[model samples]
Target chain A: MEKIIGFYPGCSLEGTAREYNESVFSLAKLFNIKLEPVPDWNCCGATAAHNISKKLSLSLPARILSQAETAGMKSLLVPCAACYNRLMVTQHELFENEELKSEVEEIMGMGLNSPIRVLNVIQFIQEYIYPGLQEKLSSPFGKKVACYYGCLLIRPHDVLNFDRTEDPQTMDEAMKMIGAESIDWPFKTECCGAGFSVSRTDLVAKLSGKIIKDACDRGAEAIIVACPMCHSNLDMRRNTIDRLLGYKTEIPVLYITQAIGLACGLSVKQTGIQRHIVRVDWQRLNSCLPEKMIKEEEDIHG
Target chain B: MYYALYLITLLSKYMAKEIYQNNAPHTLNNDLFHEIGISSARCYQCGKCSAGCPMAEDMNYTPNTVMRIIQAEDRQMDLELLSSESIWLCASCEMCISRCPMQIDIPKIMDYLRQKSLQERLQDKAANKSIIPFHQSFLDMIRYTGRSYEVGLVLDFKLRSKKIMQDVDLVPKMLSHGKLPFLPDGIKGKKNIQAIFKRTLRKK
Candidate 1:
């Protein structure tokens, strides 16, 4: 099947975490999937939107959907966690409240073409990309990687029905296909001190530290997450977290697409793997992988 | 359990004090009340934020205590512990936000309170002092790019704060491990990012 995915990266991918943006696009290309970037899409407003005016935050994305509706795109592949949540909220609102749908439609000047399936990059990879590439993966990640799904991904689960928002395993299942073992860590759905990271470092440190420490305690080499804000907190501030606790833990954090892309023969540059804070300790991480697989990869390259 | 008793005793004394001569927790960060934008307005006197808080055990005043202070007719002055380091303990777990019946963003309010206290130099922990440089770098990057460039932000935070030496050992370990990328992946339209930040910061 020629699957054409509509990609909406929110604001993070355009520049901030180019790694995530680059990897998703690369993975799409490598898998022979076509991605039509939604033009003129704005910030999803994240939880910040709801916290302010319920209408505006949601409308920010609804406006984009109105465009998608006109473009005749069947689904939107939102890679960012906050964007996924806002997009889902807009979808729910359009279905639940005709008045709201019409009001939003009137503002955006478009009629709903169809019910759009908003797939967090996880769903797209798990269902379409993973099954297709099971045989051709030249190298598996070959390490114990922890999956971090903060509240936005699955929480308010009624909205994001792709998986158990609280204990989302879509990413985990996707990882297995690429041949990396997934570790069960407790902070999977914990808040990485969201918007609080700005107004309150004292709180963000304690909260973020716990997540990193939990992953480290499980003997995991790195953590993978989907939210840009969560990525900023866990990966960017791990050092701050360590400093806060008087400890030294150097676990790298990668966006889920980047990690999965890795297992599927994606390179560091392709996955935006280098744009991380707690830098990857590839030596220790690679030690866990079977030597036979490494030799095969080198042989393939040589 | 102990928290309930503490709050009640405090409330009773607040009522008693009000009857004698009215005052509220004067030490409560006034700026926070305005920043959360509802510290005085929307809190329905519901105690759900404190109730569902996972880190409440570590706090002196539950989330409700501060709300009560803002609502109180008398000096709930003892509630100053919010600035002392108790409220700083909140995990941003958002159980407070998820459970609040009134949907008052208590965690956010608590967060602002933490920031206020820190800027006032009211913090008690050592780790927090180090975060100033991180915050400086983060905001500057955001101010410069309207978004953060990870590698640039990290290096700037370290060098600017002199915490570069603090993690000196990790540098070699990470470089040898194939983790370190010497050059940053600078974003295009650096000027646009700078413009957005300049505009946002000025407006804010």
Candidate 2:
């Protein structure tokens, strides 16, 4: 069966996290998974909308879900964890309150009666992509990675309810299938001072510093993430994090899709690995791939 | 067990009434509860929420204290909680509500306080002035493009907050990596987004 899921790249993927967007598309193609982007999807309200207006926060994500339904997609793949949380939370709130549902539908001028399943990137891989990942892999990535869930992916377990809230293993499990050794770390689900990546780099420095330090102390070579917010805090704000650490930390943060793509013999350039601020040592990771696959990658990338 | 539960409820009401009398005179309708649809009075002063909060150290009042203030219905206390940096600092991590024995949604309550603070124009009086303008810029970006435009959001936030140099150094680096696009893109259904905003106001 050809599995097709609606994709909502969200705003971060369009702007700050285009690398994430590129890798997700490439990985989906590699897995033979078909993705149809939801037409003209709006923002998911992220961390700001609720502060402005609760109705807008609910209505914005509700509109996206309705759009997915109208597009004839029963399952929507939201790669950004924040967007997934917003969509899932809106559904949970609406299901519990018919009054709020009607109000949201009226406000957005759309009906959300058709059930749409919202899956985060990790869950999408675990369900559809994981089954055939081993046969597709041309390399055993073999790098010790710290799987970071940041704040939203699994918290408030009742609403998001995809994995264990305190100790999520889905990302780790996926990494293992790609031949990367995932490390057990304390900061897996810790807050990396998300939106503060831009507004308050100092706060991000302090929070993300702890997460990076823990990953390094545990002997991980790189950090794996599903949220663009976490990637920005961990990768883009590295200078602040390093400044606060009083030493340089060279741990590269890779979106899980990029990591999976690399293990599946996707070119580093194809996976957007070079776009990261903290430069990833792709040469070291490439040696873990099958020799023929490495030659092929060199031929293609060179 | 039933008798004890009833007694505890009565005691809480009496305690709340006593606190209301000593504070500023404002009728405590069920507005906060109605807005959040969760009762803070259900919180039994458990420090679990505070213990699990990643930003609790930065908060002047812990999550439990904020809940107590709302439960007491003290106008002065409510204002203090609303104006504190803590409410703005919450990442909405939802650790509190998930761990709450009473299943109280403390994050929702904090969101309500933040909303009330913004509505009442208390941001200038609050400890964190940085988030106020950023929030406005974010909403403005959404209202314009039906989604966030990163470069536009940064420019608008910097201009509005007057923190022009905030992360200015990262602009060139971001541009080099294609992180910051100079042009903003709009969804085709932007008019529908504008309609959503307009309807939200009338509903409010």
lDDT of 1 by residue, B134-192 (tens): 55565565444433444566678668656565545545644543444444333443453
Off by over 4 Å in 2: A282-302, B1-29, B124-128, B202-204
For residues A1-302, what per-residue lDDT tens digits would candidate 2 score against the true structure? 66788999999998889999999999898888889999999998888888778999999999999999888998899999899989988999897899989999999999987668888898888888888988888988888899999888897888887788778899998889888889988888888998766666677799899998788767688899999999998888988888888767778899999999988999988899988998897456423233455578789999
Assess the local accuracy of residue A245 in candidate 2 as a C-alpha lDDT between 0 and 100.
81
Q: Per-candidate DockQ versus the true complex?
A: 0.07, 0.59
Model 2 has fnat of: 0.72
lDDT of 1 by residue, A37-132 (tens): 876455554543343234444455676676677677888898887778778878886788787777655544456755788888777777667676
TM-score of chain B of 1: 0.56
Model 1, C-alpha of B187: deviation from truth (Å): 17
Top-lDDT candidate index:
2
**Poorest stretch of ten by lDDT in candidate 1 chain B:** B195-204
